[model samples]
Target: MKLPLKRLLGIGAIAAIVIVIDQASKFTVRNALAIRETWTPIEALGDYFQIVHWKNTGVAFGLFPGVGWIMPFAGLVFLALIVLFYKPILNGSFSFAIAIGLQLGGAIGNLIDRLNPEIGYVVDFIWIWKYPVFNLADCAVVIGAGILLITLWKSDLAAVKKAQPSESGDAFNKNFNAASAADKTHE
Candidate 1:
């Protein structure tokens, strides 16, 4: 399917928003907090939510601790793959476009950090309960993936419903087969 210019623009706009928000938040945290510093937890929420200053050299939630070197390359490849498969991935679905936009923005936002030798790490600050501290980019990626998964699941279910024979159709086929068998035996 040919992607409409309007849809492409819409997706680009969403991606820009995600990147801006992610980068701005990261910039703010980097400037305001010392490394490893944690602000007091929200009083009403107990330890459920707080801001911290931490550096992550790995993927989301700080997994793969020392593999930072590969992130920028991976991000580049990811973006390229998105462009190569843009039509199929979006499939003219607005929700899929939005989801892909979020993923793309997140990938770019973190890629910038990985490529910045001065920083050499992504800034992460959001902490909630026992969850690993994360940042806005992570949020965008996660939400995008979730939206994609749900929509794909719903589409699959719809396809299955379409493929399956309806109850009345099934009944008619069964009756026709039985009638044919009886007629053959009598003849």
Candidate 2:
């Protein structure tokens, strides 16, 4: 198969996996714990970490609570943008594909929660020391964003390297200038 087609398939697969995992984890959390309920899986880490069934009607990390009504619209816009620019944005890189897939999944996962009539808020369970409760979707988004940044950085570095003249080119230019001067002197 063509590389672009392969990449698209890979991206779709990764996104589907992320969405399934995120949704399944959220479902399990919701069923196992009531809203606001907390469970400490490791007693030794109880002070540092716990699984809490928390709800957020806002963006990631519980920011801007109660503004979730706008999220569905925003998510739709994001999906539209992805559909419009996936080729250029992905740049035919596997890393870029993975990053976009992860982000897409995360966005869709949270959008699903926001759009659900029964549960209009995102279900967050994972919690760390003094940190806001979040879910697998949030983790996927963050990690995907990080990967995207790294991929962009690497691409920029490669471009810069390609733009700069290599040592062999510099040596050839010096030799050509010397030969030209020699011929002019011999004339």
Candidate 3:
């Protein structure tokens, strides 16, 4: 079934915003710094927080490197699954929509980099402590997944509560038991 135009537009807008910001930040970093160059804005926090120009040909946090060619295919499959199973997102609350949008935007942002003939790797700049260098797209994807988990947890709790027998049901059972006892006595 077709989704509501308004809802689709809202989700699309969120995704577009993520893509634009992610791409723009990556572009800025690539132009401003040479590859492997680091820039620390705060002197004291330099060791903890800094931006560096790095490239990852693999998935998040540079995992499974040298498999860049397969990423595009995996991304395409991800997009297809999102489109095919969108009913749950559409029926879910606003948070669910936001989660979906963030995920889509992140996936597309990385896909764009992988598709680029000139730079067939994702640009990552943000650096925090000893963590692997990452980018805004990665952040969005992680945050989106977190939100999705929370929403699913809440929905499960609601379902469980609904499935439990109500107080009225308990009262009815009590009355039926009493009637059955009376009938046995009469018999």
Tens digit per residue, CA lDDT, model 1, 12-69: 8988999999999989888888999878656787668889998998887888888877
**Cα lDDT tens digits for candidate 3, 1-187:** 3555656777799889999999999999999999999999998999899999998987887888887778889888988887876665565678878898898899889888889887789999999999999999999999999998887667655544445345777755555555554334322
Clashing pairs in 2: none
Q: Highest lDDT: which candidate?
A: 2
Better of 2 and 3 by TM-score: 2
For each candidate, the alpha-carbon lDDT, in order, equals 0.79, 0.83, 0.82
Whichever of 1 and 3 has more TM-score, that candidate is: 3
TM-score of each: 0.83, 0.85, 0.85
**What is the lDDT for 119 in model 3?**
73
- With candidate 3 superimposed using the best TM-score fit, by how many Å does residue 5's alpha carbon deviate from the native? 2.0
Best by TM-score: 2
Candidate 3 lands at a TM-score of 0.85
Q: After superposition, how far is residue 41 of candidate 2 from its true place, in Å?
A: 0.5
- Model 1 TM-score on a 0 to 1 scale: 0.83
Off by over 4 Å in 3: 1-3, 166-187
Ordering by TM-score: 2, 3, 1
The superposed Cα distance between candidate 1 and the true structure at residue 22, in angstroms, equals 0.7
